[model samples]
Every structure is written in structure tokens, then in C-alpha cells.
Target: MSGNTRGITREKALQLTMRKCEWCGTAIVYKNAQAVYCSSRCRVYAHRARNNPFAALRNEKRWVLWDTNKRPIMPSGAPASSTDPSTWSMGHVVNGHLNIGFVLGDGFACIDLDHCLVGGRPNEAASEFLKSYPKHYIEISPSGDGLHIWGTADEGPGTRRIENGLSVERYTTGRYITVTGRVFQPGNLLPL
Candidate 1:
């Protein structure tokens, strides 16, 4: 059927190019063809509902302050609680805190893929595992050689698995994971 238009009509071709607002039920006619929402308000609602992965996590009291060494600490450089909100803050970034850590637990989990990146790109093993979760929130680790996959988990215990000589650890509680806010791939609406 190369270069053939056997039963295709011109009207059908025009209909294929028609666009609609992703948020509202209005027709879209913006100069940018990639535009999804009709306005900023619609865009915000859509982001909070689905695109923004950190929206729900911010509501919980599982935030903690971390130092540059990736250790949980208070603003005064004291040891912080990984299970308590004693040294935790509602905001991820603080005046004295160099980094922020999210206390793992409360229906949230992080799958740590250690040493998965090589020369700023995901290695063969990491790429294969990442393909299973393309829509989840993934961030580059502090060492720049690993990845952290954040998502909801069950109420049970966490597990550790080994695959392709990489350490894959999953935890729901009793631990605090560092938050680098560095996004991986684009085309995702997730706000860093």
C-alpha cells in the first residue's frame, strides 16, 4: 500500500489533525502543537492529580533534614530521626540543611538500584529493569552511578534482590532515603 490512497478521503486526513484540551472538553488551537491543557489552571490540576509524584508524599510527616554526607541530621548538625519527625521539616529545602531526606514508610517505598549507570548512561542491567517501570518516579542517586525508583508499596516488610551484579534494595520504613531532586528522562510531566 506504498504511496497508495485506495479508500482514504481528504476529510479523514483533516480530522486526524484535530486537537483537544487534555483537561477541559475544549478544542485546542494553540501555536504549539504539543500543548495539552487549555490554561494554567487546567495544567495545575492535571499535574497534582497524576503527573506530580511528590504531591502526596509532601502531605505526610516523613520528611527529614540531611547533610552533604547523606546522613540524617538536624539543622544544628545533630543526629536526626529516621522514624520520627523530631528533626523533620515540611519543606524539603531548609536554611541550614544541605540536603533533604524522605523517611521511608507509611505506604511509600524506594527501590535502590545501585551502580546502574556507567558514564552518565544507564547500563544494560539498569536499562532492562527500568523498562518494567517507565511511568514511576526515578531519580539519579547521589553517587551518579545508581537510581532510586519511588512508588507505593505494601504494608509488609521490604526485600532485597540481586540481579545482573547490581544491588536492588526495597524499603518501606526504618530508613531514610536521600532526595536529590534530579530528574532522569524527559517527556514526563513529573515536576522535580
Candidate 2:
């Protein structure tokens, strides 16, 4: 009842096990056995709560690559348009290369805010977008003129739109994204 002490009766504990954020007391709508937090911020707080050293690299699934002409290529020298993330190798990523794509079938999707990078600066709007999911993996686009927010989003299935001279696109499944650990914001995995 005081100083982080919580008391719950049997009925209350049972009900809570059905649904509640372990971190903040918010009601978790999609409560699963592994569900713990209500938002990305809460998730970050939870992971940081434990002070784990390698919690940051949870998303380092694999490295991506592209051809000399800036085309995405798989590890076997085939066009990367069709490849599995399981086979993506870190040995292939070239430094300062223009094209990169994570192997396909990985659950992560990309929220691409195009043209948000300009004049050696990331646009304020792009920063805001990145902040919206502070736990997601983010990076500067190949041209250094855009932002790539990588994490789980609603399965957008290649939705593309334009707003305020920025191209906002979301891709879910079937594609490996241009990935660079050059994160715009780094912490925990993004909330689903």
C-alpha cells in the first residue's frame, strides 16, 4: 500500500493475471502470457528496470546488402527481392552502401518517412514520428535524406502515401528492409 508495496486479494490477483500491465497499472487489452507493458515507453522502462547489458541488440537479426549498382542482392549473389531472413549474413553488408534490405519474412515492418532528412538534418516531423515509438529500431536512409522506423506496425502491406512532401510508407512481410544499426532512437523492441 505504500513505497512500491502492493497488496492484492486472491480474487484481485486472479483478475489481474487475466489482464494488466506489469509496469504501470494500465489495463492491457491484448494480454498474453508474455504481455507486460501498455506502450513502448513502458516496455523500455521495464527492460531498463532490469539493467541488462545486451537488451539493446535484440533486433540485430541480420545484416542486409545491395549490388554495386545499388540493387539489393542476396548472399548467394541473386537479387535480394526474394530471400529468407534466416539466411541473411552479416559478412555481406558493405559500409556506406546505398541499398540494404533485411531478409524477408521477418515480422518487423518499416515506417518510411521519406524526404524527412534534408540539409544534413532530420526533419522535426520525422523526429516526432521516431519518438512516437521510442523503443523501435530507426535509422537514416541510404541517401541520408529520410528516416526508417523498424518494428511492428499494423500490417500495412506496402501502403504508400505522401504528406507534406514526405513519402510515408509501411511494408509488412515479403520484403527485407534497408537496415543500419545507425539508430535514430535505441532502447527496447517496439510495442506491437
Q: Highest lDDT: which candidate? A: 1
What residue runs in model 2 are displaced by over 4 Å at the alpha carbon? 1-64, 83-100, 154-156
- Candidate 2's displacement at residue 4, Å, is 24
- Clash pairs detected, candidate 1: none
What is the Å distance of residue 190 in model 1 from its true position?
12
Tens-digit lDDT track of model 1 for 1-192 = 334377656555455555777744467666576788877755753554474667656666677777667778866678888866676766534434547778876556688888889998988888988887776678888888888887655445677889877789988778888877787752232211
User: What tens digits encode model 2's per-residue C-alpha lDDT throughout 1-192?
Assistant: 433346766566567666677655578755466777787767654564343212432345455577767666755677555345554555334444545566433444567778887685767766555556655556777767777776544444587887555678877666666665566655443433
> Candidate 2, residue 143: CA error in Å?
0.6
Candidate 1 residue-wise lDDT at 118: 92
**TM-score leader:** 1
